[model samples]
Target: MASTSVSKKRKREAGDDAKASFVLSTQPKSQLGPVLANFPSVKPSKSTTFSCYQTGGNAKALGDADDAEFAELPTLIAGETDSVDFHSANQPTGCRYLVGVHDKKTGITTIRPAPVHTLARDVKALKSLEPIAVSVLQRLEARAALGETFGTKKAKLAIKAQERNKVDVSAMETVVDHLQESIQKSTQALPSKEEAQATADSTRLVPPYNAEATVPSEVYPLHNIIPEAEWRTLAATPFLVVGQMQRTPLLPFQRSQWINQHLHSICESSSPSKTNIKILLYISYMMFFRKFAIQSNLGKVVLEEKLASMSPVVADGLLSRFTESARSSSKPQFTSQKETLLLTHMFALCLRVDDYATDTELIARDLSQSTQSINTLFKSMGCQITKLTLTDLKRLGLPDGAAGTKRALLKVPLEFPKPRGKRRRK
Candidate 1:
C-alpha cells in the first residue's frame, strides 16, 4: 500500500488587510489521485495526510486528513483568514501538480502541471540508436574485468607467431638508413685528427710539458700544487698543455686526458694573470724534466741549453724581461712573485754545491755579474749559501761518486721572504 503526506507553507503579509501566500506539495509522493480517478474501476491504495503550517504573523500549525476519493480541493477566498492543506493519494503513477491562488479578488485556484515521467519513451529512443552486438559487448566486458592479465598466457605464443609471419622490416630499414645518413653527415663535418693537431700546434707559441717524467719532489712532493681555483682556469684550455717538449708523437686526445687525470693536482698554486699559463708551463716542465737536467750537466747548464732544450718560447720571454729589468739603473726588482720564483728555480738548477756552499761562479759569469751580486740574488730568493757534506749529500740522494768531492749547496725554503720596504730619504 502507498501512503502520502502533503504540507502547505503559509506566509502572511503585514497589514489590516494583508495578503497571504500558500504552497501545497505532496511530501514524498506523486499527486496521482485526479488522474487515476478518471478510471472508475481503479481504487486508491491509501490516503494522504495533510498538514498546514503558518509562519510569520501568528505562526501556528493546522492539520487534517483527506479521503483517497476524488473530492474537490478547497479554494482560498479573500478575507478568508484560515489556511488549509488538502491531499489525496491513489496509485503511485502520476505527475505532481502545484496549486496556488491565481487571483485573490476572484478566489480562483490554478495549478501548474508537472512534467510526466515514464521509461517507455526512453526505451523507444534507445531502440532507435545503434548499439554493439551482444558478442562484442561481452568481449569488451571480459577484457575490462581481466585488465592487464587478459590474454597474458597466450602473449608469448602470439608474439612468436607475429615474428614468424607478420614481421615488417621495411620501416626499420628506413630508420636505420636515416641514422646512417645522419652519422655520415656528422663525421664529414668534423675535422680530422691530423688537421686538429696541426691547428692546435699552429697557435702554440711554447712547447708542451713532458707528461711521462716524474713531478719534482720539492714542488709537489705529496699532492697537487695547483689549487682548485687555478684548475678551473686551466680547464678552459687543456689543449695548451697537450704537446711534448721533445716533439714526441702522442695520440691526439691522450695528452690532455692524462694531464686532466694525473697532473691536475700537481700544477702550481699561483695568482691568475696573463703569465699564469706560462708560469704553469714552466712549473710543469721543471716538475717533469728536473731529473734529466740535474743528471746531464751536474745542474750547471747554461741559459741557451736550458732554453733551447726545455721550453724555447717561455725561456726567451722570461730572459728578455729579466735582462730588461736588470739593465735599469735602479736595483733589479721583479714584476711579480711568480717571476722571481721562476728565476729562483732556474738558478737553483745551476747552483753547484762545494760542500753545502753554493758555487755561484757560473751563474755570475752568465749574468755578467760579480759573485757578490749573484750571492745577493740567491739571498733575495731566501736561499743560504752553505757547504755540502757527505751527510747532506746522502740526504739529497746524490750519487756515490760525489761523496769524495766538495760541493756548494743552495738551500731554498718553501716560503719566500717578504720583500724589504724601500727606505725613505732623511
Candidate 2:
C-alpha cells in the first residue's frame, strides 16, 4: 500500500511539471500586452462570432451582456463572443489584428494571445500583391459596370469632335472653290495700259541698208563732185557761205513767215466771240518775247528793235485788246497766259527806253496800265480792286506791307546803263 501511494505522488508531480511547462510556453511577453490591449478598444461590441466549421465546438459569449462566466484556462483555445469565431482569433485577417485573453484559473483550454503567425503570414501575402494590366482591366470593367458614372459624358465629347470635324471639311471646300474662281478670272483679264506701253517701248526695229555698196549715185551726184585741188582752193574762203547767209536779209523774213503760219493756225482754231484770238496772239507774242529776251542779252537791243519795227496802231491795238480782256472777264481764263503777256509788255518797254536806266518812268507807265487793267477786272466781278490792301495780300501768302512794295517794285523796268568810255587811271 505505501508503494502505491508513492507511485500516486510521482504521478501528481509529473502532472504538475506538465502544467508548468504549458504555462511557460503560452505566457505572452509584457511588451505584447500594451499592443494587444489596444485591440479590445477597437473590437466591435455588437459583432457576432461563429465557428464556420462546427457549431458545438465553439462557445458564444454575448459581449457586454449578462452572460454566464466561463472558467479560466492556461492553454490557448477558440471561443466565440456572440457569432464571431475565435478559432483563429490571434491571427490577423487582411486588415485587422486579432487578440485574445489568457484565463488564469482552469488548466483546461481557454482563449489567450494565441499564435499570430498565421495573421502575420496573411498580412505579408497582401503586401506582396502587385498591380498588373489585368488589374487595370478589372478596374475598367468595374467602372463600366457602374455605367451611369461616366459613359454619358464620354459620348457627348465624341459627338462634339465629330461636329468640329464636319465644320472643318465644309470650310476647306469653300476656300478651294473661291481660290479656283479667282485664278480663272485673273487669267482671263487683259493687260493694263502701262503694260502695253512698256511692251511697245521694248521692241526694236532694224533699218534697211546694204553693207557693201559703191559710192551711191543718189548720195554723191556727179554734178556736185569737184577735183581735190579745186576743193582745197575753195576751203580757204570758208566764211563765204556763212557771210552770205548772215547778209541774206530774208532770214528774219523767213522766221517771221513761220511765226505767221503758227499765228494763222491759232486764229483759225479760236472763236471770235470768246476773245480766243486775242488770247492766242498774246501767247504767240509772249513766246517770241521770251526767245528774243534770251538772245538779246536779256532784252537789251533786239527787243527794242522788234518793238520799234511794229506799227504803232497795231501795237496799241494789241495792248488795248489785252487790257480790255483783263477788264471784261470776272476771272482770267488762263492766269499764266495773262501773267506772261504782262511780263513781255514790261520787258519790251524796258528795252525801248534809255532813260529807264536812271528813272522808272517806263516802269511806272506799265504799272499804271496793269493797275487799271486789274481794277477793271475787279469791277467786272463787282469788287473794288483797290480794296485789296496789304491785309488781303497777307491772305494770299504774302507778308504784311508786301502788297504795296512788291507791286511798286514789279512796275519798275529792269534796265542797266550802257557803260560810257573806258576808265582812266587814277
Candidate 3:
C-alpha cells in the first residue's frame, strides 16, 4: 500500500512539472485527453513539433474554422534569430508574444515582437506600439458581431467610434502623413490621358469596340447547353447594333460586342437617353444594378415605364431568353444559346453585387412575365424567394426607414444541383 502511494505521488509530480513548463496556456493538458481520444491511432509528425504552449492534440483539434481565425497571424521560426538556444528552442524567452505588422504601401506582412519604449523610436515604430493583443482582437470581433446582430444605424456608428478609440494617439498622428503619401503615389502611378490614348490606338488590329469582333461566347455559348436551332433563330433575327438597327443576321459575338460598346458609352455619358437603351442592355443594367436602378421610387417608375414601350415581339424574345438562361443546367430544355450565355453573365454579376439575394422585378418586367413566373425561374437556379424585413434593408445600406417598404428578395446558394445519372438495371 505504501509503494502504491509513492508511485501515484511520482505520477502527480510529473504531471505538475509538465503543466508548469507550458506558459500562457488557457487550456490544461488534462483537457487534451479527450481530444487525443478522438484520434487515438493518429500520431504527431516527427518533422514538426509543438511550439511552447501548443500541444499536438490541440493543434489537431483546430479544424477549418479555427484555422481561418488564426490565418492572419504570421509565423516566425526559431532559426531566424541566433539569440535563442537550439536545445530548448520551443520557447523563445525573449519574445513573450508575437505581433503581425502590415505595411500598407508595400503590401507586406511581418511578424515580430511588440515594440518597447525607446528614446530613439521612429514614427513607424511608435505607430506599431499600439496594444493589439489577441484579447483586444477577440473583443473587437465580439463587438462587431454584436453590432451586426443589432443592425441599427446608431449601433454601427457607435461600433465605428469604439474602434477608432482603440487606436493609439501615436498611430493617429501618422494617419495624415500616410494618407498624403498614398495619394501622391496613386496620382504618380496613373498614366497620362494622351499616353493611354496612344497605347490604345497602337494595340488594336481593328478599331476599338467593333460590333463584328467575335467574343468567346460565339464559340461556346453557355457551354452549348441551349439548343442550336434556337441559337440559329436568334442569330438570324434583326437587332440593334451600336445605336443602329440592323436587318441582317447578328451572331452571338456581334451582339456581345454591341452590348459592351453600349455599356461603355453609358459610362461616358452623364445621362443616357431612353432611345439609346437596347433590349439586352436594359435587361443587363436592371440585373447587374438592381439596388441602384430601383432604390428610388422615381427610378423604379421610370424603368418600368421604359419596359411598357417595348414591343410584344421583343418582350416575347426577352422572356424566352431569360427563362432559358435562368433554367438549371440539370434540366433538359430547348433554349437560345446566345441569350442564355448573356443572361448567365448578367446573373453572375447580379449574384456578386448583392452577395446572395437578387431582385427579380426588373428582369421580370423585361420578360413581360408575372412575379410567379420570375420566382419560378429563380427557383430553377436553386434559389429561394425570401422577403426582406425593415432591418434587412437597413443592414444592406438602403435609405433610412425606406418608407417601411418590403421586397421579395431571392436568396441564392453557392452550390447548384448536380445532374443525376440513370440507375443500373436490377
Q: TM-scores, in order shown?
A: 0.21, 0.15, 0.21
Where does candidate 2 clash, by residue pair? 48-83, 48-84, 49-83, 49-84, 50-83, 50-84, 92-119, 101-112
Supply the TM-score for candidate 3.
Answer: 0.21
Global fold similarity of model 2 (TM-score): 0.15
Order of the predicted models by TM-score, top scorer first = 3, 1, 2
Compare candidates 1 and 2 on lDDT and give the better one: 1
Over 4 Å off, model 2: 1-274, 298-302, 308-426
Q: Rate the local accuracy (lDDT) of all candidates.
A: 0.40, 0.35, 0.40
Off by over 4 Å in 1: 1-312, 315-345, 351-358, 395-426
Put down candidate 3 lDDT per residue, 1-426, tens digits, no spaces: 465544444445433333212122233322321110111232223453322122334323322333322312222221111222111212223434444555554444554332111111123334447775678778779879988788699889888887787857676785888989999999997889878755754442211122222431221133132233422322211332343444212321223343444445543456653333333334343343333222432233343454553333433443444333334543222334433344444543343334335566644554445867656545544456666666667666666654343233433222223336899999
* TM-score for predicted model 1 compared with the true structure: 0.21
Per-residue lDDT of model 2, residues 313-405, tens digit only: 434433332332346654323234544444434332222221111123223342334555543322221122232366446544555654444
Give the Cα error of residue 102 in candidate 2, in Å: 42
Candidate 3 Cα RMSD after full superposition onto the native fold (Å)? 32.5
